[model samples]
Target: MSQMQQITAQGRQIEQDSFAIIDHEIERDHGGHSFSPEQWAVVRRAIHTSGDFEFAKLFHFSDGAVERGIEAIRNGAKIISDVNMIVTGLAPRRMQPFGVEAHCLISDPEVIAEATEQGSTRAKVAMQYAARLGWLDGGIIAIGNAPTALYEAMSLCQQGKINPALIIGLPVGFVKADESKRDLMATQLPYIACDGRKGGSPLVVAALHALMVEAAK
Candidate 1:
């Protein structure tokens, strides 16, 4: 399908003709030392939490998801990544952010094996910590496994389980992964999902900005 066709079907509201947008209040205190105190505060807050930040999240596709996840936590967001070793590989990185919780969905064993340290002590420890704290309970859930993941975000909405300001991070670079994200958008939840080839963390950030900006109106 052509890009034009996809756009037409989605009925997108193109106000800026900018599908991929990134918005961050440019720090006036730039350079290396700028916002040193503020940055520390962010890090400290993340650390204070027990790896479970009341923030709902969403992540799919790409094995490099861990890198994006680290970025998400730094920005005070939770994560839901595709089932793989990305989270484990990023365990050390995420540990610093402190209370950043992560949930993952699995489908392929070959991919899983290629992703994690299957039985390694550190990996096991991370898993244990996540489970005990409700930070990593997501494994594989067919329809029974977090189905609300895509079609509906009722988990966050109906029960008010998370902060209404919760955001989603979908960095999927896979084909089928697009469907899941589309399902997510169907719910109109506040989220950030960027295009794969034409984006990176910027995509998620753009979506975040859209929600924040739209809400104020």
Candidate 2:
């Protein structure tokens, strides 16, 4: 039941060591911004997952984002990710207890064809398709590779086409990445984001895992 024994059994000494390093780094580099306990936990895990102290500063969340995300997960909300990487990174066991599955439609032939026909990115098309299928309604959206996907999701919410329970918008790119997240913040939706275009699939999965762990508790 101890941390060290569990680490040895799981062969996750690297992860344990990384968390130790993250704790040391945070103590060494923490600034004036004091986060709430929940926010701190998410930020701490993100740092532990990526070994990036900068993430502690870059991560952003709307008011009650974590609470709402945990609620949705506890209610067995499906997770719709923008890319396959996010889906692949998600541990099935982590979500199985919630009776939900992680899904990605970017590679689906219909999604690809629609993206090409509409002159849009596959990520954007995938979001639109999910919306059309009523999948985003009350679902958790995890977007980590394409800004267009986040933008499309926000637009759908604006148009009253869908209402996702929570959105993890961390797409990493210069073109419209920061702007897309900024726009997402303007909406009424709860969201977790990494500001200024500094996020990726790993961070997205890390955020979800943190939320799921928090929900389980």
Candidate 3:
């Protein structure tokens, strides 16, 4: 066998072993939680990605959030992200078969220009642009690195401007990250979020990929 093929096999084996370990540890340590199987898939993926079992405690899922998120993925929902890291992290092989499209407009020229003119964040302006283009309706908005983006998404949802199928609000920082996630939980929107500031792009990617994986089944 080719060396490259051997390395690929080894990588897959490592991933499988890691997941096995995560499952065993989570079962041993946090078996009392009430998450359904699908929700547990997402939480397990988060733990696998971050190596932080604390994610089992930090994750918050709204009523039917996992079902709605999986439904949206199966329906080929567009995914709007606050930053490019999430866009890059989402595996195309996992998304393309389901016709899912992930976008990050934070670096768009128009978004940058508007944000500069308004003295606001590029993430916030990008969300406004997405709303104007009607992409938020029935889409999955994943905000993993910017509190401003999460705040704007919540504002738009509250104003009835956009009705996303699911919002993954997991921005990380010392600023308004915790407050934004709390505000999202207070809303009636369909959502999955981290309860505190301990979230990032990888968590969002893990959550979405988990949903995609479940949808395929």
Q: Candidate 1, overall lDDT?
A: 0.33
The order of the candidates by TM-score, greatest first, is 3, 2, 1
Candidate 1 error regions (>4 Å): 1-80, 97-148, 152-165, 169-176, 186-188, 195-217
Candidate achieving the largest lDDT:
3
Candidates ranked, most accurate by lDDT first = 3, 2, 1
Model 1 Cα lDDT, one tens digit per residue, 59-124: 222232223333444444444433343344333332343454444434434334533655322322
Q: Score each candidate by Cα lDDT.
A: 0.33, 0.86, 0.93
Clashes of each: 3, 0, 0
lDDT of 2 by residue, 1-217 (tens): 9997887667666766776777776777675346777777788887877777888778888999989889999999989999999999988878989987889999999999989998889999999989888889999999998988898889898899998889999988889989988888777788998778788899888989888888899
Clashing pairs in 3: none
So what's the TM-score on candidate 3? 0.95
Instruction: State which candidate, 1 or 2, has the greater TM-score.
Output: 2
